[model samples]
Target chain A: MSAAATLIAAALGIAAASVLALVSFPARSVLVVAVNALLGLPPVVIGLVFYLLLSHSGPLGWLDLLFSPAAMVAAQAALAAPIICALVHRSLERSWAEFGPPLRILGASRLRALPVLLGMNRRAIATAILAGFGRCLSEVGAVLMVGGNIAGHTRSLTTSVVLQTSMGNLETALLLGLVLVGVSVAVSAGGIALGGARL
Target chain B: MRKLSLSLAVLLALGGAAQAESIVLASTTSVDNSGLLAKILPVFTKATGIEVKVIAQGTGQALATAAHGDADLVLVHDPDAEAKFIAEGHGILKREIAWNDFLFVGPKSDPAGIAGTHDAVAALAAISSKHAAFVTRGDTSGTDAAEKRLWKKAGINPAGADWYRDIGGGMGAALNAAAAMNAMVFTDRGTWLSFQNKRDLVALVEGDASFINRYDVIQLNPVLHPNVKIEPARKLAEWLAGPDGQREIGAVAQGGEQLFHPDADKVYVPGT
Candidate 1:
């Protein structure tokens, strides 16, 4: 879930961040603010919305993704995209000031400079995507709401831990919780290593 | 980056499409959480070579999933919902696979003095009159449906009452919450038997005919849901009600006592 959702979120987030940094639209600041505000949206609410959408009765029910891992990936990606977008936008805005004028002087279009900007801030963008990965790795509310937490199917480390805890297997739950923490910690370390210590 | 995304997407599609021939079974938490499936599902798969992917949810949601064609079949315990589902042509077969009874599990204090009572309705009324803390699984699960029926029998709404607690979660969650606050909770015997966190809770009421939990295995209607894997699901339903499956179900014991009494042979009517 973390890997797939993070990758998908990275693609969408980077595109959104490029628009925010490159474009001079009237509501650009509003969109930036909106993406930032979306970070405050509880994962549970996002999960519920996706649940309604992916349910057999929902509009997108024809996809037949409900109670499937694909549905979970979609929910997790939706949950992580905003976080990646906002953080990448913050980093892109800083570097765009440096890259924008030079690229414009070189007779480059905003779309053409998109790849150049992405290459220049690859480390920081990697950092933002990893942050989104960690969020997806640890998120249970949205995953459970959409995944149905099916045994041997949609069950994940976090949802299983929640199950064990409710089953009064606190010792097992604690061990699983440690695994989750350890994994996220490892992801953070990997992000730093890949980002070359860039934030 | 494009190569990476493509591979990841392929990996995800593979993950989701694992064992494509498998049948999805939507069941109640009580059946799955009781650890009975762990003992029998492997054997069932080995005998049939058809995988059954079990997704445990509330009976309400389980049936709803099958109705939506998201699930091929359901193994659940709510008669009212099952009847409605059959009436609506969402499912067919409806063979009784196992049976258990609901137990009034509450704090050992016996605040309402319901221990040893066989009359669930009276016990509930006493609990309501005394205003004892009663935790309810308001998530529309099988046990929650039974609790509602009991409350109605006792002529008490208990909706806005201070003593009533609606946890709106699964059976395990409701039991955990009940254990936390030392509140009374009505739960199926299978879950109650496997529950390890006794804490201050005890069985307050039992042996009521009204609390009998009959689990039925229903196949998705082939006529209505032409997309369902009806053949494999039907084979599974038959195997569950067959001699071998019934033996396995009845043999599953928790705390040195059988959790479920197999009722498949005793009562299964065709085309009902």
Candidate 2:
């Protein structure tokens, strides 16, 4: 369940960054600043706000998002998008600063610069996605708030580990912990591989 | 230098003495939020002079803490898990101390029209069939466990239902979610009374056999770990179930409302 959520978050992050990068003025710079500030937003607070929005009395209560995987995905996406965008933005900004003069010297048009910018920051974008995935995979508070930890449905690896540990199932919790570590490692490796292929 | 060293040694000795034979007690937030511990523990301290540090988590987590020996004693409400803990030999000398009822509260709109239905299962079914939003304490707390039992009794699986929302959080948080969502929830009467932001929710279905929630005090079995502080733990448990303990439990208040009715006689029946 967590794996699927992380995949969704990664896709969301990329899509969000792409939109922000294409539409905004001084796009990379704006994204970098916004993402850096958003990185500090507490996960618990995010969960609480979403909890209200999705609850029955809240305006969006009709959506019935509370305690669903969709709610968890929304939380993970909110948490991951900024960091992913920021990293990609920074990478693009730095690449622009370094390559702008050279590209101009080579008679490159402004139109040609966009693809060059993306190519140079391919690894940075992958790193951003990986970071977002890591944050979503391990988060307890947001998931707990939004997902409701239903055993077969909303429960994720982190929440399960906490639950198992609390239930005095140390061995199960430890095994789950190991699985979390493996997932993290696999995600990082995948990110690097994908970034390498892109570059 | 010798005089300074002597004073330092004296300070260290005094600090250790001040620390005394302290034991950790993990209990339900209902007890903590109700201010029962403050009234009761002083009596135990006066009698045994053993200091106790209370850590409040949900009943599920409280039992889990005792299972890991993270706490010397546990006071929680989930009967099935409590029985399982004792059966697993993680706890010993368990006894009921108090009980309260669970209330099904929801928006005054009463979308499900569950009011007066004394059957909790039927009420839940009505709420589900009507697709009225229901907030569940998905945190696996005792309330969550009871909610699950009710859902099962209703012959409906709420897991993937669009209206059954699981906010995997403590009772208070879950109640808050229910209130904000204008959704129905099953909560301990104690937490519901103390909850400040109930919005427009009111108690819809209550006073049923299934609504009875009992709390127990148990000392972790010293047999499991020889290092367990059995004597102090026993002292605390005994004190809690005794006269002074009952008084303390009865006296706990929130907004001038008594939070729990301590059943020292253990004669408090569930359904009646």
Candidate 3:
């Protein structure tokens, strides 16, 4: 359940970033920089804001999503958005600069050239999305705060690792930590493969 | 964007509806780690068919969560925090459910040589004087509060001492840190009874009148959160403070040592 939610969050982040990059706004450079800065946003801050927003006394509490898988998804998405946005946007901007004028000289419109640039950089875009996936997989603080770490319900690998380590179950905690590291390494390997893929 | 958000909202609502029969209980990690809830909650669920979704945090966090109306009920051991919560109109019908005691556990070598002492303050003073390593739960928990009280009583400022370390974690974590460092730690008897990784540490100071730990249950005020599952939450609270629940609590013993004594029917006076 946690893995699926993480994937969904990464996908949303990639989609939003791609759309933003395709649009030519006057403040595009500032927006890109802002997104890059947001990449460094701490996970606990995201968790705190979400906890307040989702708490029953908060404004959005009417949605009743506190300590649920949906809240976990929200946290992961918030944490992933900056990474995906900054990486994808940078790649898209660079590719557009390289491919734009040539396509224009060929009498192609900007709208027609957009998909060409995206397709040309699909591998890099995939790499960026997978990098976001790796971040989501390894995150603990945000998810633990929003999901409440309820066993058999909201508990994820990283949260369980924290709980076990704190409870003197070093063996179990180390095993979970190794599993997380293995999964993230696998994801990074896939990203490397995609980056090396022939477009 | 609107379409995506709308679909996500619908999905979350559906998931929430499926859990309509469950109650969200904000509680402390000490209670959860004691293994007492593991024994009692199952029976309550089996008999009542109500699912309990427990969010085990520190006593302070549990009370704060309940105050925010995110929880249907709360169980914690900090009497001052509970009183403040009820006074703020976030809770109602506070019931004293059970009782335990706190003690100092340290290395078997007894570096401070205060083992088997009935004076908690004297033990802490000895530990400070000997410059022995001491792990503190520093997380604003009930046990942490008691530890601070003992330090105040001892009239020593060990905060910056090289021998004192605050781990800012739960009871189990502090115990684990102490085990790893061969340090001394203050913990409630319930978590100590169920803790499996004793390693080289043994209970040092206990049987002190000032070391009593009392637990209480409170339902989130229905007026504050009208949408809370008041009926089931109140039912669970009543069950926890009733004869059956007290019996279950008393029955939970680790290695033939009782972790908590049933005290639901007894009148609890603060600071007694």
Candidate 4:
């Protein structure tokens, strides 16, 4: 359940970042800094805020999402979205500067310029997705707070590793930890492959 | 200059001599959060002169830490897992120290209407049939394992659909999530009473035969790692099962409510 939720969150984050990258913004440095700063926000803090918003006492508690995968996804998305968006933003900005004069001289419209910019920075976008996946897969604090780790239901590889490790089940914990590492490595390899394909 | 150098050397030697050997104890969050160690450990130090460091984690993690010899001793609940540890030769000389029961807590309105059911399986099934919100501690802790067993006994698959929610976390966090959602959740009574976010939720079901939760203390076998402080670890475990430690365990408090009952005298045979 956690794996599925994390995958959904990664997809949402990448899509949101792609849109943010496409939209024109002034003061590129400020936008990049704002997004980058959000990348460092603690997962537990995000979990806490979500708990407040979705708990019975909170405004949106009616949604009944306090311990659900939805809550986990929301928390992960909050953690990953900004980082993904910032990476894509930086990539597009650099690529745009490189391609700007030539496209303008060729009489290309802003609409035409977007695809060209995206094509140039596709590697950066893939890297951004990989970064988001890494954040989602390995996170313990937020998932522990929001998802509630209910075995067979909400347990993720990382949480399983933590729980098993705590319970003295080193064999199972090590197995889970290795799997988590494998997932991360696979995501990184995919990112590299995607970047290489673009080149 | 020579006299100053000698004085500095003496100070460094004194500092080195004062350094204590640290023994890591992996224990439950309930014991850690209740501030019990602060009250208890100083006395142990005074008597034994060995500084003990407590690393608080859930039962699962505590057991795993001991298995790896990352910790010298483990204090945790969940008998089946503890037995597995003993059988696997990761731990030795397990002793019962304290116990508490699991409680079903939900919103005051009782959306699932399981208020008085003594049968945990029946209560879970009713909650599912009603399609009311239910919070699960999906984090694979002992409480989570117990919850899964209840659902299995009830013959209901708790995944899928909007009614069942998995909050992958510890008991306290899971309880808070249940309280927040006004969803029914299975939690240890100790954590339920100590939890700070018990606003709209109250204990709806408890005192069933199936709700007993026991905590145990055991030392990691020094045979696994010769460097492990097995002597002190065994002493701590023995102390926990002895009268003094049992007394200490029975005396833990939250708002004047006793959080656990010391069960050192009880023999725990699995599947009983």
Candidate 5:
């Protein structure tokens, strides 16, 4: 339950951050530095921020989503956003530098040139997504805090590994660790296929 | 963008209703690590057909979770925190479900020579004087609070002592660190009994009257979380205070040692 939710969260976060990075690339100098700094936002800090936000007395307490899978999703997304944004922004900047002059010479507007630039660097974006997804998969601190690690409800692979290890269920922890490795392999393999399969 | 948000909304709605027949119980790791919940909750489910999903954390974190409106009920061992939870109107009431005691475990060599002493304070003092290795769980947990109280009573501040190691983790991790360092650790009887890897550690001091540990179950106030499963939460709390629950708890043993004694009838009122 938590694994799937985190994946969704990572995807959504990556998409949003990547879009903003791509669209605002040429216009904002300060945002570039800010995005770079945000790449180091520790997972635990992200979890704490979300915990404060989703707590009963928090501003978004009306949503009442704490300890739910949705909250875990939100936490993972927050944790992954900065990494995706910074990396995708850097990759998009490089592509723009490489393709900008020729595209402009061909009378391609910035709006029309954006998709071509994205296509030119599809592999880098795919790799960035894979790295962001890996970050989401291995994250334990943030998701554990926000999701509450409830059994059959919000427990994810990483949290389950921690729980099982602490409960003296070493074999169960090892098993879950293996499952995490397998899932990562599958996701990265699929990412490789998608990256190579298209423009 | 529209499709993504729409799917996310559907997923959240589905997750909310996924466990309608179940209730989320946030309890301490001591109880779960003892394997008592596995022994007792199944019987409750069989009788009531209401599945109980448990999230085992420290007492402080468990109460925090309940206060956040994420948990339907909480089973924890910190009385002061539990009281504050109720005083803040987060919970209905606190019911004592079971009781245990804390024990000091250390290297079997007994380097501090505090073994066989029934006084934890004296044992702590002796350990401090000797500068013997000691491991502490410093995560603001119930066990951590108890250790702090003992340290205060002993009039000793071993925080920066080279012999003292404070690892901010759960009970199991503390025990593991104790075993690895062959140091002294204060632990609940439940986790101590169920722990499989002892290494060079042994229970050095016990039987302190001040070491009594009590467990309580508190149902969150329905008004605080309108969507909480109050009916099942109340049912589970009542059942735990009743005969079958007590019997199952008492029946669970580790290495021929009973981990907890049920005293709900004597100490806790069921419905209040």
Candidate 6:
């Protein structure tokens, strides 16, 4: 669930960061600060808000996405997107400052320069995706609230660890916790390999 | 992988959430943590072709979810809150499916000497006077509601007392906290029996009539929300109250001890 959800957040974050880099909107600064600030949004609050939105009586209740892996993915994506956006936007904005005026002089539109700038900042974008994936992998509150933590269906590694710890199987819980850390380590190593270790 | 994209598609589709195949049941941690639902839910699903997705939380939270029309049914143990739910027209087709006793467990040393006490009220007063370290669920769970009632009856408030620790967690978490502090607390026998971190906490007071924990099943009202899967919900309620359901519930045991007593045979009706 985390991998798949992180991928969706990556797509969204990359797009948002590219827009923030290429466009010169009046509210760009406010949105940039907002994205950076929202990196700390509590997963539980996101879960609760989504829970209400997907509730049977809520406006989006017709979607019937609550208490499923899909809802959890949505919550995870909401959490990871801001991190990806903030981190990637930092790199994109830096490179855009250096390349923007020259590219515009050469008759390239902001829309056309988007892909060029994104490609130039590949390492930063990759690091941002890794950070986003880490956030998704570690979060428990949001998924627990929205996913319902159904054993086989929506129970992810972190939620299972929590359930085990609360169940008093501290040994098993610790083992699962180690496995979670191991997954993060393995994924981080993979990210460094693919993106280089400049971060 | 299929449910992944399907979930997104449904979200974007903004269409009616497909069919009435599976139902979401809001339940308590005791039911889920005890492994009871893990055993019987699949069986129930097989027999009825209706999958039940359980959201294991406290009774208060579960009731809140059902009140918001988020759950199709509720399998909870707090009768007072269940009564309030029904009175508020949030529930119907209520049935008493099982029973267990909540235990006052503390360090085996019996810090407040509450051991072997049949009167739970007197034991609370004793614990209060002795300033025994007590951990409360404090999360408005079923056990918390019962504990609050017992404190009210004992006419002593331990709210500000340092010996009182409100962990504000589920049954298992509260038990773990109590065990760590050697604090006395109330817990359902199901969770206590299944819990592995006993450390030195033992049942100090039990078998009191006040400690009886009755588990009930209530399906959400379909009239309030036309989209509710009331048919499957009603089927689940009847199954739990029926012979086969009771047998399945009774068959669930841990550590060679039965955790819950199936009491669907003794169903409760209003007034009489």
Full-model lDDT for every candidate: 0.85, 0.73, 0.83, 0.71, 0.82, 0.87
B1-272 in candidate 6: lDDT tens per residue? 34445545654542233244988889999988988888888889999899888889999999998887888899998879988988887886689999888989999999899898889899999999999999999988888999999999889888989999999899999989999999998999999999999999998999888999989998777788667789899999898889888899899999999988889866555545
Mind giving the per-residue lDDT tens digits that candidate 3 earns over B77-119?
A: 9877788887887876788899999999999999999888999
- Residue A100 displacement in candidate 4 (angstroms): 30
Tens-digit lDDT track for model 4 on A128-193?
767877888788888776665544434668877765543334577788888889878987887787
Number of the top-ranking candidate, with DockQ as the measure: 1
lDDT of 1 by residue, B10-97 (tens): 5468455854778888999998888888778888999989888888889998888788777888999888888888889887678899
Q: Output the lDDT of residue B139, model 4.
A: 64
DockQ class, candidate 3? acceptable
Clashes of each: 0, 5, 0, 31, 0, 0
Q: In angstroms, how far off is B52's CA in candidate 6?
A: 1.4
Instruction: Give the winner by DockQ: 1 or 3.
Output: 1
What's the best-to-worst order under TM-score?
6, 1, 3, 5, 4, 2
C-alpha root-mean-square deviation, each candidate: 2.4, 17.3, 2.9, 17.2, 3.1, 2.9
TM-score of chain B of each: 0.95, 0.87, 0.92, 0.87, 0.92, 0.91
Cα interface RMSD of each candidate? 2.8, 22.7, 3.0, 22.5, 2.8, 5.2
Best by TM-score: 6
**Predicted candidate 2 versus true structure: per-residue lDDT over B140-242, tens digit per residue:** 6777888899888888998978898988776766776787789998888887786666779888887889889988888777777454568888888887888
> Where does model 2 exceed 4 Å of error?
A1-199, B1-19, B266-272
Top lDDT: which candidate number?
Answer: 6
DockQ of each two-chain model: 0.49, 0.02, 0.46, 0.02, 0.44, 0.48
Candidate 4: residue A199 lDDT (0-100): 59
Candidate no. 4 TM-score: 0.55
Ranking by lDDT: 6, 1, 3, 5, 2, 4
Return whichever of 3 and 4 wins on DockQ: 3
